[model samples]
Target chain A: MWQEPRYQKETVRENPVEEVKKITFRPATDIYEMPDGFKLLLEMPSVDRETLKVYIKDNQLHIEGEKKKDVSDGKFLLQEIRDVAYERVFELGDDIDADSISARYEQGILEITLKKKEKEPVKEIKIQ
Target chain B: MYRPFPPFGSEFMKEFQQFREQLNELLKNVASGDVHLASDVMYPAVDVIEQDQQYVYVVELPGVKKEDVKLMVKDNSLVLEGERKEPEMGQDVQKIRGEIAYGKFQRTLPLPENADLDKIRAEYKNGVLLVHIDKKEETKPRLIDVQVQ
Candidate 1:
């Protein structure tokens, strides 16, 4: 049976200490099941390699990054992109090999490959 | 004595402020006929900034290649067209969940009359595109000294 990845919702604090609160947005993601394993792609614009982090803990995969603002001194005439952090979590199944997971980030896209564990072969039984 | 609700600097107030700003932007876009509510094509978010000498347009286009993008100047508008192709997968691949938008996108922005289209320059880096349009020489703010009578 194939298990779908679950998303974990984060709770916002009722009272924040900082004057300027940093918002976190969930990046768009795509999950695909391959012959050998699973592939995940996340769109995180303005996120660089230095600010991106991909890790696994307790059978859950976490992808988080902070978008760096390049030009801060200019006055915005039309502002659409918000300065926020990107975060998303997905639960991994038992069929995946946690240790064999690999990730790469390029052009603001993070690609992750999770290998599936090898299954046991069945033995043929002969009856007299 | 009257007190402000959400206590001025509270988290809820800050979030409300952010929401208001976003709503204002959305309303502005709608008024300017820039919002496309019925279109299936993805319109990359943009931020236009005004500087001393030039106007900058920053576009967010994650997962798009530079070769697939096309930029042009038509009349008094800057047109941006690009395609974000889906990532290549194996023949037996099965999509479990897809939230990313992948396809051709087009966004046209009306340029100010003072913008010097001849001096336009663009650069793509880290999935972000930066377009700088220099201001015309005569239109730029100039300092003048008055003769003392």
Candidate 2:
């Protein structure tokens, strides 16, 4: 004998909500390969240290921040700069040591350094 | 066909009008040419905002030092000049990629009629320069009460 479990098939509905879309721009970057590591420089104007975020996830480097407008209430005589967030990402090579990465932010420029991992030496096997 | 030229409508007047139009076209081309030349150098982004008491000018100059920038007010125009030097790296370092613009930049913005040039103040922070110019006292809006008869 087989018994069927009683259950109610209720449809789940999601409420519609309005969302604000934010504009994002990619900051200009310069990459250099140093003797022992790699250095990356990003130019992100008006982005302060407190708002900037730099991290590595899944072997990819991510940098993002928002440029806040200090004066919000004003009539624009000439508007050229836009209120937007800056984001950029780069893929990391396997030779890079993720644990030894370091960064510094100054003068609206972010500098990140990624060190290379130590290579394993080759073992010479003697004739048996 | 040649007839006696009327004093009011003559060929000289038509020639003058044509000359004026040509002069206007030439001036427009020259103005646009100047903008094209300016673009050859670095043109930093700028924003001018007007407030009740003052006008603010914001200029973005990243990777530039404060000492390298110069601001001056001359002939009812604000002149901004700066240079962005490339960072020095080690001799063994190799460039993988470069996208940043580095060079001398000059930008001039005309001041508004109501701006008080003498009261201009500037500040620089985080590679952004802010210039505040107070508005003329008499030019500001004022509320006047009308006397009832």
Candidate 3:
């Protein structure tokens, strides 16, 4: 049996139930293989190139940023989304040369190119 | 001495407890995310479609910059991860209601064998991420001519 509520309620409740947050926001990215290196495209909308931070830590690439927040007075009919902060970590492989990692942000996309690390030569010793 | 049903009853309760434990674990997995993981799924509603000619993915990420998104091919899977945050709500006195999920999210999708990962292209316009995986030219079937007998 289904019972419908009699009236539509618009008043906001003081004690709202806390729902589990879904984990989804890591930026939408694309990886391409070029002749020189692998190109990683990151989509970070509304983030300024200067404000964005990118670094490699513990063999993982971490990206952090924050959206601009406003605190002005305004009448609202309806509000849905909440203020957000961003952080993402990517585990890098041994083949990636940390020293050769280079990143550039353009048009809301962070392009990171990971150059292949050169193999080190092994030396042989002669026993006299 | 009537102890026939006691053994069966104990087993049923044990099974029930195990079921409850599994349910709790599942719930915690959904809720026990860090601040960043929560925002990823809460922000965008995305759709991934694989067709005969191309692999198309559509992501609805409003107010997010293109540079903020990071797509990767790790372990033969395509991972879509990003963050979408809403600006602070102003200083107004009002009763608060239900709030949906927010924070960071990571969605990894497996790629098909025919997906031309080498020639992938993506564009974001009007708060939508459109990614196109072009099929390899050699993989496209060509029509053959047959002489009249």
Candidate 4:
């Protein structure tokens, strides 16, 4: 079995203001390892682009977004779809280039690509 | 992705397609450990809302196009069918974490007695599919007024 890379485990965080509690669901995501970097596909339907935030802080990848309410006037008969906010956290490793992270959200899917850092070669010391 | 009781009714319990849906959903509940098993069966989450003259059914289908979804009304039931095409996998790509339920899924619900199948309409937006089912005028509730004698 191929072991997942070190940058896989994620931890959710709370907003700076700790007033009323907000529900945060871990967005269902797919992570794939490419020859050059890693790609993450997340499901976040009904989320607006302006409300989405993706950034890296303290070597942790943070993703947070707000979903707009589309049908607020009607009474819900079957409420399987809850219009809740979403958040995700991922710890980044030295191999990852935090500056190169690129993301795109379309049709409710957010795709993020993280490029890996080039490995450095070790040099041997010469004795005179 | 597991929720509280699914609330699936007896209508779903009686059909072979229901069995497939259950298996697909069960695999999704255990998808973190068994991704391959979860393929081909994802109960796309949905919500059905009631309006004055129509019933609206909404389903979240991220990464799916309108052409990939099919809506049908028959035998007093409404059926939703769709497929999420597998992402193109280059020869060098390797899966590290697979959690999104991919592939085909089907859901059927008993239509209201007042449903007018002829006027059903569907629209896709931001990964959400909305199907508006206009209720027959006879089936819609109307308030009656009586003049005081």
The candidate maximizing TM-score is 1
User: CA lDDT, every prediction?
Assistant: 0.80, 0.78, 0.55, 0.78
The pairs that clash in candidate 1 are none
Worst 10 residues of 1 chain B by lDDT: B31-40
Model 4: docking quality category = medium
Distance from true position, residue A75, model 3, in Å?
A: 4.6
Q: Which of the numbered candidates is closest to the native, going by highest DockQ?
A: 4
TM-score of the first chain alone, every candidate: 0.81, 0.77, 0.61, 0.77
DockQ for each model? 0.40, 0.29, 0.02, 0.49
- Candidate 3's docking class is incorrect
Candidate 4 global TM-score = 0.73
Off by over 4 Å in 1: A1-19, A123-128, B1-40, B139-149
Per-residue lDDT for B1-149 in model 3, tens only?
76565555878899989999987866653432211132225546455565556777666565565677889887767788876553343344221211233367667767767677897788876456767776665645788998989
TM-score of chain A of 4: 0.77
Best-to-worst order by TM-score is 1, 2, 4, 3
lDDT score, candidate 1, position A31: 88
Each candidate: how many clashes?
0, 0, 46, 0
- Rank the candidate models, highest DockQ first: 4, 1, 2, 3
Docking quality (DockQ) of candidate 4: 0.49
lDDT of residue A3 for candidate 3: 13
For candidate 3, report its TM-score: 0.38
